[model samples]
Target chain A: MVTAALKEDLPGAGREISIEAVSHRFDLEGAPLPVLDDVSFTIEPGSFVALLGPSGCGKSTLLRLIAGLDHPASGAIRVDGAQVGAPDPSRILVFQDPTLFPWRTVRANVALGLEAQGTLKTEGHRIDAAINLVGLQGFDKAYPHQLSGGMAQRVALARALVNQPNVLLLDEPLGKLDSLTRLAMQTELVRLWQQSGLTAVLVTHDVEEALYLAQRVIVFGPRPAQVVADLTVDLPYPRHRGHPRIAELRHEALRHLGLEASW
Target chain B: MASIELPLEAGRAPAPVQGWTLLAALPWFAAVAVLLLVPDLTYQPLGRELALIWGAVGGVLTLLGLFGNRLGRVGRWSALRGPWLFAIGAASVLWTVVTAKTGWLPQPFFPTPQAMLEVFLYDYGKILHSAAFSIWLLAKGFFFGAIAGFLIGVGMGWSRAVSYWATPLLRYIGPLPATAWLPLAFFIFPSSGSASVFLIAFSTAFPVAVLTWSGIAAVNRDYYEIARTLGASPLFLIVKVAIPSALPHVFVGLFMGLSTSFAVLVVAEMLGVEAGLGWYLQWAQGWAAYANMYAALFVMAAMCSGLITLLFRIRDRVLVWQKGVVRW
Candidate 1:
């Protein structure tokens, strides 16, 4: 039984991700504005990694690329040796804004991916499990407008979880929540990542958040983003907030982000 | 006593009795007295019937004022609402004195209350037929126009090629009123009824198409991105994402289209229909049967208002999620 539990905790559920020399740009008033600067990184299967960066550093853009919502201008992104051509149910992105369909109830919003995959009939119970996982059991019938900001984000996360995706690409998913909610959600994120056994890539500007949750925090520089530092948090899950290692890593991340770390 | 005095206060009490309820019956009694005492200057056929109606209203109001507190909140509210009933009674008495009791306002132009009543009683069948015919024509044209507009709007919204083709044509033709299409429409269609339908549909289709287009265009790009990353197909994006997001705008379009259809329907009916409220109005005017025209106009107003209310009811039900967020 102990062996079986250990096996379940292994990386069997998550797929490996590789980004080889990926670059992307946006057309701003007819001028090509580079966002991702030939950035390349590999994420190990079932690892919780945070893409820590200042705002507009293209970390969110990278998350989108990994989700296969947008194609990189150059280079390739592969999941377990297969290059992703388009969005697949195996990968999902939860945006900063919950972006819940305002017309849909919480349950209906969570059911979106299953509905898209035509698997709702068989896997319908996943919607309930997802809602419960996010601690939004009683709000299943509530509309997006009725929800508080943190609850709406929870619904968004639940929406991503319902798909049972191998990789969860969260693009600053807790960026809009209040500081207290953000801190609470940071712990929730770690618990969820451990429970699901999926590869989690969180893009966040909050250095402390990265340190608190991710097993590895990959710090990024300003626009046309390139990797500046990748500090692995060697601590285990249920990390102490007052850990000295977290303070050191946060200072290191802040220095790379060009911010004066007062703390 | 304080509870009765401050009955209208929020959450004070569900049922509140007002002493003014009994006073509401007074004006109706006054109108009835005037109907009996006043001398008729013209031959008003339904004066007795009018008096009976007034007497009945007064009797009902008196009964409601006396015992409506026992019927709970809705009843108590109605019983307390007596000023409007008084106003109606006062207006009737004044109208009788001016038109039937005296020759202050000339006949055929300003008919008496009894003359209006005569038209209602005697010409009920013909008016009902015209009203029914108008409704059928309105429904057909509105349904077809709404469906066509919705399709065009969705097509234009989702496809670059369709938008490219439709935009120029819409700009050129959409601004022109349906009356401008009248002569051409009649010339093309075999029957004037079909021609009228075309006009109503044409008027309705424009607003619905434009609003639907704007609605779809205004959708947040983040919504599309969210759906896409969740494994939605291109078709699923349009139908599930684009359509539902655009429904509020579509309803706005439908409402605008519906009102415009009423105007076009009247114009279309006046131009060629054998029977309709509009045709009946024109016919009554031609024959100097002013009373019939008045009755027709009243029916037309009631029908239009009723249809609008029905649309609002449907909108409320369908867009229940938008209750506090968007107010039409």
Candidate 2:
């Protein structure tokens, strides 16, 4: 399995990323609607964190800011130690949709990140191995159209994994899946994280999903969003859904999120 | 919720192989058998020609049928995807055969299909040279015109300022068909072939430009945003993303432009060009050599069919995503 250390190490030695007073705004009512006001956070090296929030909160926007897919209206965003300006291959972002290029088959799509890096011909077998790691071995030649929603998303995950990003950012990556597939993908993602050592930060409205996957969950309140709560998951690897502590923590997280209990 | 592995070989289903040559030879065997058994069926001029043409047609159909494993390989067969050249070839032969039997159509008096085939085989060196000239004219007209139009269209589409300034002016000129430019071209151009080339270029450029512009306009906003987010250079976006994404639409323009250029060349050739399929067609018609006229018509049909077939094949191979097919 490839590791993120292969990327150029960000200077200032220890810091993985830092967001300093970053804020985002949009024009609403012909005036500024502060979606994220003075939002400040820091992600430590090799951390598995989740940004949790209710709908319409700027959780996804925060993730995008760190990935440099969007600029903060104010203040600085840094990856490692340097300021964020644009998306770098070293910080891969996976969206809710698979976003696999439809013209390419699954293997080709999975290999594309490496292909873009001009390393595929020298490391093509590595791509195959990554796909195999994601349990998508048989789907190597299948077109995106031919795969199920779950399978296609797995290919997207494989594509991201193949890049060996220092920071793996996901924007509700499992929100579009059926319940069973979402559960399966969450497990697969955790497994991938342990094996590949990706510093993952996922943003989602699903409190349970956030709690289930992350080492630490950070919940943000509605617009002008800021971290309202942070909780550590002390459960071991392959945590069971039926565990009493898991349920209690999930309910507690949801309650703080102001969402009615659905489970 | 454990990650699961699927069997690597589960999805593949092997395709059946077929023998097309054997299938084509079946009709030949049948025709030979009929000729041997019935002398009455074998001893006529029209019968000989029908047998020859039928052998060719049957050969093609048998090839398709025998290679049934490959015939309907994938995708739907709508009008846009039909085998137009094959239809044209079959139509040409059918017209010849029907005209021969009924004498209903104004007739050609020169040598028949058998004669042309023999001429094609023995005097091919000379025929090939003439074919080369005709091909050159076709190429010159198509390439220069299509390229000019594509570039102009891409420019117009990419730049709103250019489109705003140039659209009305071009629209005014585009309606005037290339052939209509022939009279003006006659006085201005130094030679007949050059004039034909200019006419074809002007004719083809308009649609190419129009198609290119529309193709540019059709680019999704998301793609641009994606490129920008990736920090792609302006050159990279235009060369890599914009051009490829616009290709399907540009090809439509090119195919139509090519067909139009060829058609226009026929009328253009009649002006003063001494050689070409169109020139030969007129030569035969002037002498009332209806058989030669028919033969030339057959050749022209073959050329057009060949061109369209070639373009479709190239398009299919290159634009695998587009999945264009030849129907009928």
Candidate 3:
């Protein structure tokens, strides 16, 4: 009951994101290696979208660009008609590695965004709320080393949610978790995004995960990555993994990722 | 071993002290008997005092064996050091026999333990004064140097311009011994005290600076990105993310600096300072007062170890999270 009331008071408001002709590259030694090539998409406000691609296909890079942690080499990413120039608290990125500051306890790690925003003094209560939201109620003082992979990622989620970001850019956030934790976190992710009323863009290679969690799964091609397929998961909430529609989507999604989908 | 038994339940009586545990008092009692019954060939000061100390140790160990269960942490600890107490008591008795009672060894050079004990009894005032000076000097130099090194390391780590300039300077200066600059130090500084401080600081700064720089540089790039996306400013990124991430390395640098500071402290005091453990050792050695020199050496050992222990305690407290993480 306490958690329910606290969740309602938590801060977040979904916002629209527009990526137009976005491209990015990295220099290895000397030559330029293009990663994202003219990738463009629009994410409606409060919608859950999963960017499914093969490993190293630049879906994660796209998430980084959306979060404004890094800029695309060319083209504009706008949030509500404002050119995204730098990272803002409104769009928080949860990294694949959790990247929780090892020195900080769970409470301190969750408090980071607010602490940086200078809102910690007034909104310290949000930290406890977010921790409870992640089901880490009794682990506020636990260090990262003391946590399992799933729990650490939960703390990472709590950390990002505490700031109440409008767009949660997950760069394969659950990609490293064990299978069971991965499934559990996938469910929790949908619940968290829906409850927070925030737009979420998850970059993952897991086709089933993409279909299971997101409203729409956008597939990408390899290397200088380009859009390969755009899919809308028409299934209802509490979608079954063994559902006939999910299997069809998985086959189609794998085909787009250059897999045979033999099974 | 008895005390290291499987822990008793809360409010339960502690495991009964073993027979061997009670035997810890045997060596001390033997030492007391040897001191009282053995006739000394040479006059050794503090013979009675030595016997009394051993008698007290034997008495205490006996009491601990009988009633240690009722006591708390201290009692448990003393019980655990049963072997250590026996070894120490036997070693003392052996040393006294070989050096003073038989007069088997050369005189003056191998003064009995009591002769060294006499230094503590009579010359404690001057010796403590020297120890105090050493502590003050070490604290000043190590404190200033460590602070400066930490700042420089952070600068070098965070800013390219600072790193570009500081790297060359650090590479050139960090490896060279701080005492190598003694000539310049003495000439430039206004007083011997300042010169000593500078030398010790120089010794401490190199390791701290190098380590801090490496720590900052090795920080995970994702850490910075995570902080930035959370609406952290550049200042916050450096202070909250980069610094904490690099802390394990910084502590390593601090440790290296602390030990080197001790070496540099002694060298500086011997060369320049009017008072300090090194100066006391040098002064006593000049007068052929080997006992006094040995006493000062003991004091120096205790001081260095004490400071090192303190640093380790701080590192443990500050980097408690780092304990089970990585190589830390």
For every model in order, the fraction of real contacts preserved is 0.89, 0.11, 0.96
lDDT of 1 at A196: 80
- Write down the lDDT of every candidate, Cα atoms only: 0.86, 0.71, 0.87
Which CAPRI quality tier does the interface of model 1 achieve?
A: high
Query: Which sections of candidate 3 miss by over 4 Å?
Result: A1-7, B1-21, B326-328
lDDT of 1 by residue, A154-224 (tens): 99998988888899998888888999998899888887888788999989888888899898999888888
Query: Deviation in angstroms for A221 in model 3?
Result: 1.7
Question: What is the i-RMS of every prediction?
Answer: 0.9, 4.0, 0.8
Chain B TM-score (model 2 vs. true structure): 0.68
**Which residue pairs clash in candidate 1?**
none
lDDT tens digits, residue span A115-231, model 3: 998999999988988998999999999999999999999999999888878888988999899999999999898878767888999898888999999999999999889998899
Best-to-worst order by DockQ is 3, 1, 2
Question: How much lDDT does candidate 2 score?
Answer: 0.71
Distance from true location, Cα of A30 in model 3, Å:
2.5
Tens-digit lDDT track of model 2 for B13-113 = 42343333344345454553443344441123445654666567556555544444455542112112234434544454544444443444443453444
| Among all candidates shown, the one with the greatest DockQ | 3
Order of the predicted models by TM-score, top scorer first: 3, 1, 2
By TM-score, the better pick of 1 and 2 is 1
